[model samples]
Target: MRSSPELATSASLRYVDVWKYYSGKPVLKGVSTEFSPGRVAVLLGPNGSGKSTLMKMSIALVRPDRGYVSIGDRRVDEDPIWARKVVGYVPEDPVLYESLEIVEYLSFVSSIYGIDVPQSRVDAVIRALRLEEHLGKFIGELSHGTKKKVAIASVMLRDPPVLVLDEVFSGLDVESARVVKLWIREKASRGGVVVVSTHILPLAEAVADRVVIIHEGSIKADAPPTKLRELGEELEEVYLKLTGYSAEIEELVRALRG
Candidate 1:
C-alpha cells in the first residue's frame, strides 16, 4: 500500500455559524463545528437536511450565503484555491470527462493539482480499486460503480490533508465498499482529517470518531459513537429520535399492518 508523506502541520476544518439558503429556504442554519486531524467525522442526516451542502461547502464547491468556513488558516470564501488544495473531495455525484480514458482523466487531475507523482503510486491505487483492466476504457463506457472508483482514485492520488467523501459507498460493490472503509481508517491513523457524509449507519459505526447529526437545517446532536452505545442505543435509533422520525415510522408501520 502506498503511504502519504509525513504531514507535520496539522489542519482542521471549521464552520463558524454558517448558513445557506435556496430560494429563501434555509438548508444550513447557523451550523458550527470543527473536524480535527487524525479523526474521521461522519455527517448524518435525512434527505435534504444539508449533508451534501455542508460537504460541498467544505471544498468550496458551494459557497455559504452567510457565515464563514475555513480549512486550517485559509478561508473558503476568500481563498478558494488554497482551501481546495488541502481538500480531496469525492462529490455525491461526480462529473467526469466522457471522452477521456481512466488513465487520461487521472493524469488531468494530477496536472490540476500541480504534482508530479510517480506512476507506481497511481498504479497501486488503481489496482487496489480493481480498475486495472478498465484503465484504458473511456469514462463514458464504464459503469457507474467503475466511474465512482475512478473518481476516488483521482482524489486519493493527491493525498490531501483533508478528505471529504459524500456517499462514497453508494454505488460500490461489497468488496469495494470494504476497501474504502479500510482506506478511511488508514487515512485517519496517519493524521489526515476525513469527513464522510453518508446515510450508511454501518459505515458510520465502523469509521466515525465523531458523529454529527443534522435535522431540518441545524445540528441536533454531536457526539462520539461510543456515547450512543453507552446509552444502549444504536445509530439508527439515535438518528430517528434526534430527527423526530420515530412517530412517523411507527405510523407508517401501523398503516402497513392494517
Candidate 2:
C-alpha cells in the first residue's frame, strides 16, 4: 500500500485572471480567486455563470485560454498529476462503470491513487452515507442519488487536501445532504480547503464560510456569510441582486400573468 503524500499546511488553490473559451464563446472571463486551507468557499451563480468551469480549471480538467490556475505553488496546467494528487473533485455529473458494483468501483479508484484503502474506512463511509445496502448493487442498477454517493465515497476515500464539489447535494436526499454538510464542515475544520459550487441556496447558507457570487464569468460579490447577514441579506437575495436577475424574473412573472 502506497502511503499518502504529506500535504503542506499552507497549501492553497488559486486562480489568477483565468479565462476560458469554447469554440470562440467565452466561458470564463479573467476569473480570479483564492481558496485557502481551513475555509469553505461557496461559489453561487445562475446557469452559464462559469462556476463549473472554475472548478474544472482548479483540477486541470479544463485549461484556461489565458492566465493560470495553481494548487499551492504548482500550476495545474503545468503539473496536472501533482495537482490531482492533492485535490479530490466531485463533479456535478458523476460517471461510473455500469458493470461494476459499488465496492468494486471504489477499489478501482483507490488503485489509481495507489493507496490501499482499508476495509474499515470504506465501511465507515458506506455507513455514514447510508450506502451499505447498495454496496453489492451494480452501478447501472443504482439510482441517481445512490450513484452520487458512490462518487462521493470514492473521493473521500482518498482524503485529499483539497476538495472541489460542484453541486454535490443535487441528487441526495435530505438525510444524505445533511450528512454531506457535516462531513464538509469536518473537513474544513481539519484544515482542508473546500470549494463548493451550487445553486442550492439553503445548503450555501448552512455551510459557507465565504460566499462568492459569479455572474457572466466575473465575480460580483465576495464576502463572509456573516457579513451578508449583517447587511440584512441572505444568499438568495444577494445572488438575485448581484446577478441582475430580479428585473428579468419580474418580467417573466408579468408575462406569465398576461
Q: Which candidate number has the best TM-score?
A: 2
lDDT of 1 by residue, 183-246 (tens): 8999899889899988889989899999999998999988999886665468898889889998
Q: Name the runs in model 1 displaced over 4 angstroms.
A: 1-8
TM-score of each: 0.94, 0.95
* Shift of residue 82 alpha carbon in model 1, Å: 1.1
TM-score of candidate 2 to 2 decimals: 0.95
In terms of lDDT, the poorest run of 10 residues in model 1 is 1-10
Over the stretch 141-168, how does candidate 2's per-residue lDDT look in tens digits?
A: 9998888899999988888889999999
In model 1, what are the clashing residue pairs, if there are any?
A: none
lDDT of 1: 0.87
Return model 2's CA RMSD, one decimal: 1.6
Error of 1 at 100 (Å): 0.3
